[model samples]
Target: MGTFKIEGGHQLKGKIQPQGAKNEALQILCAVLLTPELVTINNIPDIIDVNKLINLLKKLGVKVENIGKGSYTFQADEVNLEYLESDAFKIDGRGLRGSIMIVGPLLARFGKGYIPKPGGDKIGRRRLDTHFEGLINLGAKFRYSKEDQFYGVEAEYLTGTYMLLEEASVTGTANIVMAAVLARGTTTIYNAACEPYLQQLCKMLNRMGAKISGVGSNMLIIEGVKALGGTEHRMLPDMIEIGSWIGLAAMTKSELTITNVSWDDLGVIPSVFRKLGITVEKQGDDIHIPAHTNGYEIQSYIDGSILTISDAPWPGFTPDLLSIILVVATQARGSVLIHQKMFESRLFFVDKLIDMGAKIILCDPHRATVIGHDFKSTLKATTMTSPDIRAGVSLLIAALSAKGTSTIQNIEQIDRGYENIDSRLRAIGAKIERVD
Candidate 1:
């Protein structure tokens, strides 16, 4: 396991540009399989998870060309469907949770798609029911093999129908939409995840000749086409990373500017941080967070109730940043409740923050109450392990604001999401180094 040795108590400066949206890149890369022509994608994040998916695509015989940094052209004209049955594919498909998305496009075009049970962060149980059920609604057959922990779907022809999802799962919505794009008739999805990334996916599909409407709403209507053609697409900035950078600036009392942050798509993120008494200034498309020298404060409800921040569907605060908010609150002037309703074990990382001297009360598996220290006491640096991607970055933020050097092991979890995090932070005056 690699480690990050960070020396805390230094304020970071300079501007950092957020990488391309990792979530969007995953879905877009899978969508490339729907067409046999060249599909050019720009601003792809060079994170571990995305790289894994790219390599997996190469193994499946997609002709991938790296035209430039963060740009790639993919042509799936000669996809080796036989590779799906190989043991190597079983192992490769299991290495990435995003690998499950490839099944949708594969099943749509090739009549069959198979994947080993996908692997990702151990935050909670992420069920594939939404994806499979949506496909089944479109007249696909699903099967599972408990012995090999594999899943497969097949359809000689898919007929579109309406589906009201049980949950607004982002990846689930993307997978079903990709499958539905090539179906025989019209398809309507209700309660679909309408996050910016999903909207980008829908728009990209439309550019590829698929007739999809309601680009930014919970209800999406897709008219099936005979075949999709290749098209170029550019990904949005990673909002989760942008949120993390904002939290990092406040905790370290730093003046930092995040550039080109697609402000309109960042629905509730800026306002949510503003609720924490942090100044999220809008300079064109950039977000400028000034040094919180006097320390930021948490805002209470007008009715004098302790402010509560929770996750919901699009236009709501993302659960991915709840850990960042919780960490940022540790140094704020007031108290706030963080409810991580999406995952049961995400809040368990608060114990690591407690060990670092933050005043946090883990109310339950899904909730935590944080009482701010207002920078009256600096966190004491110590050794810790990264539990997951978001929590790992949250702990790294805490370490950067601590009084001394800290060691964070299992940093691979962080790399799965963030692109060259240590190097990027160092460029902006952060005292962090990677120890391989």
Candidate 2:
């Protein structure tokens, strides 16, 4: 594990660009296995999870080349199917959750696919039922071995059909879509996740010679084709990262400008922050967060009830960002409740913030009440450990506004998503150092 030593109470200035969407990159990289032609991708984030996926693709015998910084060209024309039966895959596929996506394209292009039980952030029980059930509905034979913890799927070829998902899981939708793209007949998926990341994936597949309709809706119709061709794709900016930066600016009294944010795609994120009384300015393509000298305050609803911020599906405020919202709320003037409906364990990080002098009550595993300090008192720095990717960044934001130097260990969790986070923070005048 690595550590970050941060000297707090310094306001930051200047511009920073968010890397490519981490979640999107996972889906896009796995889709490379769908075609035999060269698939070129741009704006690939330099993060640990993404790099791990890239290396996994190479180990599976996909010809991958780095064209430039954040650019790569992949050709899956000569994939080694035998590797899937090896013990190496059983070990390699367990590193990240996105590995589950590779099974879809492999089953589509070839007759079989194998993957080890996937692992990711231990926020809650993330099930693979959606992925496996969707594939089985498309005429694939699925089986799991309890002894090895391996999932195996095989079929002569998939036959597309109509299926309604139990939940609109983002990665589950991507996996099934990849499988359905090459299956015979037409596949109609209802109750799908239509996040911009999934939308971009559908668009890229359409450009590669697949027919998919209902790009921006919960219902998607995909007509199977004999084979897919190669196409170039550029990932959108990371909305989660942009939202984090906005919260960081307000917490530290920094005037920060985030460039190339694709403002139209950031649905409900800016408004969610603005509800916290943070100053959010949309200047063309960039978002500007001015220092709140008066301190941010929570806005009340029309009925004069205390405000509540929670997570939901796509159009809803993303569940991934609630941690950032929770940390930022500590410095606001009024009290608000944060409900993390999706993951129960994510709220446990609040104890660390409370130890830093912020006023908070852990209502339960899924809820927390934050009473803002109104900038009247700064948080006292202390030693802490990062639990996961989003929580790590949230703690970093809190530490930046604290009164003294704080040491944060287990920063490897933060590096899994954000690319060059320390260097990026330093560029904007933050006093953070990376220590081994």
Candidate 3:
């Protein structure tokens, strides 16, 4: 456990590179289990969750090689199929939510897989029904032990079939797709998630001999193949971190250049920030945010009504970045409603912001209205506890903009997603120090 002490009111200015997409890296890492060949992945972020998943793979007997910085070669030919039954398996599986994806590939290859109840950010009730139901549709028999909180699935041989997901869950879609890539016959998924992460996974699988079509659409078709070969894949820059940096720059009145952000992948994030009157300049593959002068007003809808920011499936604002948006809005010139449609308890962290002298009304568990101080009243620094990954970073941004100094405990929550965040922010002149 560690804490971050930040001296606020500094105008950060510099160029920084966003880490590889954590979501994409998690899904891509799980895909490596589908093929026994030497799968090389590049641009992998060095974060806790991704590293934990990699470590889990290593313990499962996958051959892991540190080819270079942020790169690895994985071969699952030697994966110990019996390891899943050990007590350690449940411990590792529950460490992070991404470990749940390992079940799909394992079940596809070995006809059996099991996972303990997964642990992750307690944003809301993230159900595994979509995942289990989709796998069951593919000819897998699933069993849950309520007492032990264990989830297990097995099959003689997975047979492909049609599945319409209850929701286009990002991880759920990735899991089902991985299982479908090896099953016999064709698999069709309607209402599938088409995020860039899933697209990258499908592209990599296709390169490795999986017949998958409809890469960027809500519907996907997969013709199961008997085997897959190794392929080299690179992860996309994290769009969530990019959005966070943009919010940080706006909140701190800093001029920042985010390098190689994969401009085309950031759907409506730039526009959403622009809605708050922050100027985002797109140059080639980079995004430049100029220092903002006070007077940032929340843009009312064309109907001339109150502005509301909410999350939906891909092509919509991601729920992960809603906390950052809420914090940035605390300094904007107008009040706006933040509706976190997906997660029920995520917005509760706004209470910490309220304690920092922010004018926010917590309407309920999922919605809050923030009235910006617009720099007329500088936020007073205070000690706080970092909750989850996204909320931790959001509070860090708030601390950077607040007056005097603030201390944040449980910064490990922040480190789980953002790679070397304190060091990276310090490079850009942020007055942040990490203490053990």
Candidate 4:
């Protein structure tokens, strides 16, 4: 376990580049199992979750190699199905929610797939029923083991058909897509998750000979093929990371230029942040934030009311970024409501901010109202522990801009998403140190 000892009240300056999308990279890595040929992926973020997924793939006899900096090559030509039943495999299943996606591809290629209850942010009841239901709809059989707390699936031949997901679960949508790619017939998925991450997965699958239509919309049409060949694909830049960086710059009143942020993919992030009064300049694929000349003002709707920022499925404000947005709102001029509809416990982290002299009203488990003091760096830092990926990073950002020295324990939670965040923040002029 490692901790971050950060000295706050420092401005983050200079230019930094956003790494590959962690969410996209995880799904694309699993997409490698859809092909037996050599598949090389570029712009891979060397994050903890990605490495864990790579290790899981290697254990299943997939040849994965770190060919270069931020690049990886995988060949699943000899994937052994036995590893799916191993206890070692089940132990790592809960590492990230993306691990559940492997179940679909493995079951499609082989006849069976086994995974323990997949783990991710303990925000709410993230049910795998949606995932299993979609697979079962495609002629897959499943059993549950209460003793081991694991789930298993088997299928003879997947005959795809029209399926409607119970909810727009991101991982569930990716799982079905992987399974349907090699199925016997066309699979139509409605109410799919069309986030940028899933979009990249669909595009990469298409490049490898998988016929998928409705790339950007909720309806996905996948024409099953016999097998898919390998192709070189590059992951998209991390929009979540870029959004976090933008929030960091605005909160600290620092000038920064984030490079290689696929501007086309960041559909609603810019406009949402702009609603909070953050001025952003887009030059090509790079985003520039100029030291926030006029401090951010609390956004309001046209009805002369304080603005409300909430998350929905794709094309809405991402649930993963609500924490960063909530923290940034603490320094805005007025009040805005931050509603995290997807998770129940995500708003609990606001207690730390309230302790820092920020006025926050915890409306419920899923909602909070933040009245920004525009506090002049008066947050007196104290000891805190990271809860999850997004909340942990938000805490780090808050600690960096706090008044005194703050110690954050269990920084590994932050590493799962943001790659080498301490080093990256240090490069951009943040006064933070790592202690093991």
Residue pairs of candidate 4 with colliding backbone atoms: 94-119
TM-score of 2: 0.99
How far is each candidate from the true structure, as Cα RMSD in Å? Answer: 0.6, 0.7, 0.7, 1.1
Compared with the true structure, the alpha-carbon lDDT of candidate 3 equals 0.93
Task: Give the alpha carbon lDDT tens digit for every residue of 1-436 in model 2.
Answer: 7999999999999999999999999999999999999999999999999999999999999999999999999999999999998998899999998999999999999978899998889898888999999999999999999999999999899999999999999999999999999999999999999999999999999999999999889999999999999999999999999999999999998999999999889999999999999989989999998877788889999898889999999988999999999999999989899999988899999999999999999999998999999998889999999999999999999999998999999999999999999999999999999999
TM-score of 1: 0.99
What stretches of model 1 exceed 4 Å from their correct place? none
lDDT of 1: 0.96
At residue 369, what lDDT does model 4 achieve?
Answer: 92
Please count the clashing residue pairs in each candidate, in the order shown: 0, 0, 0, 1
In model 4, which range of ten residues has the least summed lDDT?
371-380
Compose the digit string of candidate 4's lDDT tens values, residues 1-436.
9999999988888999998999898889999998889999999998888888998898889998888999989999999887777877778777777788888998888877778887877677777888999999989999999998888889989997998888999889999999999999899999999998899899989999999999989999999999899999998999899999999998888999999898999989999999989998998889999997567887689999879999988788898899999999988888999989988888898898888777899999998999887765467788998988999999888887788999999888899888888888899899999999
As for model 2, its CA RMSD to the true structure in angstroms is 0.7
- The better candidate by TM-score, 3 or 4, is 3
Q: Encode model 1's per-residue lDDT on 142-201: one tens digit a residue.
A: 999999999999999999999999999999999999999999999999999999999999
